[model samples]
Target: MIIAIVGATGTGKSDLSVSLARRWGERGLRCEVVNADAMQLYRGMTIGTAKLSIAQRQGVPHHLVDVLDVVDEASVARFQADARAAIDGIIERGAVPMLVGGSGLYLAAVLTDFRFPGTDPELRAHWEAELQRLGPADLHAVLADRDPAAAAAIGPHNGRRIVRALEVGDLTGEPFSAGLAARETPWRPYRQFSLELDRPRLVARLDERVRGMWRDGLLDEVRALLPLGLERGVTASRAIGYAQAIAQLRGELDESEAIAQTQALTRRYARRQVSWFRRDPSIEAMDAAADDLAAQVDRRVAAELVDTMGG
Candidate 1:
């Protein structure tokens, strides 16, 4: 059975995954992790992304992390294929595959029968030009008028997603939400667990985490990636903290302003993640702050695995 550990950022998803894998290993059940977070997929984006180092992983094999250069645009369709292939290989070798991250869309694409609509080059180019000319806010306003639900979901700051939503509407003559609305049967048998905390607590944690990123030298990390084409990266360049760091590096925003902006954006992103995952009825929610959370999850997962085997 595939195990999914999903939730908002700073909810200890990574720590939980490592703990679960280590526990399962002790019990003779091998578990390997496959990352679903988009920013974590890019190489050299460690500090801002909260990506675990080799020592922190404790010998657990991880897949799909640091697999792409900063300059490469991350596509959900491509990730879906790559992640599924990794899971298939893990299952073939008699190990449990764990999908772990805050990215709701990437997790859904891998766990469900989500299909991508074809894109037209001309239409994509048109939206890109519009994004450049009108900027994210204006382009987002156009999307809000075309599809209010999509606009609400994508948000005004995310020009990439806004453009895609508009392109999808014009290309398919359907709201972008239509694609996300279909909750078809999953492609594989799986159990999902979501870690959650109260909004006040989560917001505090998120703000502190963003501050910690900068304290841990996020600026230096961005500097390292700049030579690797970070600014040229359509997707990577716009990641919450990375963008702010880049702005600070370019002297556009002062250090305090950049840090504050990143904190605000991170909190906003966490809210959107909560909203997205709450829509999935298949996930079982757990309190992230519970003292025995890992033990509780391990017990539940053990019971589910036995049931799946018997059935």
Candidate 2:
């Protein structure tokens, strides 16, 4: 069985995953992490995504991190394949696969047999050209008319996602959300947990985390990746911190302005993440601030695994 560690940003999901793996390892139960964050797939995007360093991983193996260049567009379908393969291998070795991330769609893509509609080169090219000509907001408006729910889930500034949503709607002759109906079957049985933090505390954590990202050389990291064509990369360039940092580099935003924008955007994105995950009734939302959180979560996972794995 697979386990998903999901929630909003700044909720300590990564640390908890490592802790759980370490605890389970003592019982001779091997566990490895599978990356579900879209941006974390890109190499050299360390500081911005708050990825765990080699030593910080605490000897737990992680898959799919840093597997792509900044110029590569991440395909959720591709990630589903890669992550499931990693999980299958871990299971074959009698190890647990921990699927961890805050990206709602990415997490779902891995946990479920979510089928994305096929893309059309001619149709996709037309949408891309229209997106370029009309700009994100206008294109978003067009999407709203055709598939309002999809448009609502995607941000206006996310032109690539908007284009894909429209492309899917056109091909299926149905709203993009149609493919995402309640699933009777997933890849396998899994116990999913979502860590939650109250908004006030979450805001403070986000503020501190944003400052930490800056102090830890987020700007410098972005600068280093620019030579790798991050600026020209459509998908990578729009990453939360990278986009703001790029604006700072181009003199569109000062250092302070960039940091402020990053914090605000991160908080907003966290809300969206939580909202998305909340819609999945299968996920047990854990209160991260609770004193018994770690114990509670570990016990549930241990019991369920024993039962499901026939221990």
- lDDT, model 1, position 90: 93
Residue-level lDDT tens digits of model 2 in 1-311: 89999999899889888988888889877899998888889999999898999999999999999999988888878988899899999888888899999988888877886887788988899999999899999999999988877776676777888889989988889898665563435879988999999999999999899889889998899999999999888779999989999999899999899999999999889988888888788899999887756567788878788776668
**What is candidate 2's CA lDDT for residue 256?**
94
Across 137-158, the per-residue lDDT of candidate 1 in tens digits comes to: 9999999999998887777888
Query: Considering every candidate listed, which one attains the maximal lDDT?
Result: 1
The weakest ten consecutive residues by lDDT in model 1 span: 302-311
lDDT (Cα atoms) of all candidates against the true structure: 0.91, 0.87
Q: What clash pairs does model 1 have?
A: none
Q: How accurate is candidate 1 locally (lDDT)?
A: 0.91
- Model 1: number of backbone collisions: 0
Model 1's TM-score against the true structure: 0.95
TM-score of each: 0.95, 0.96
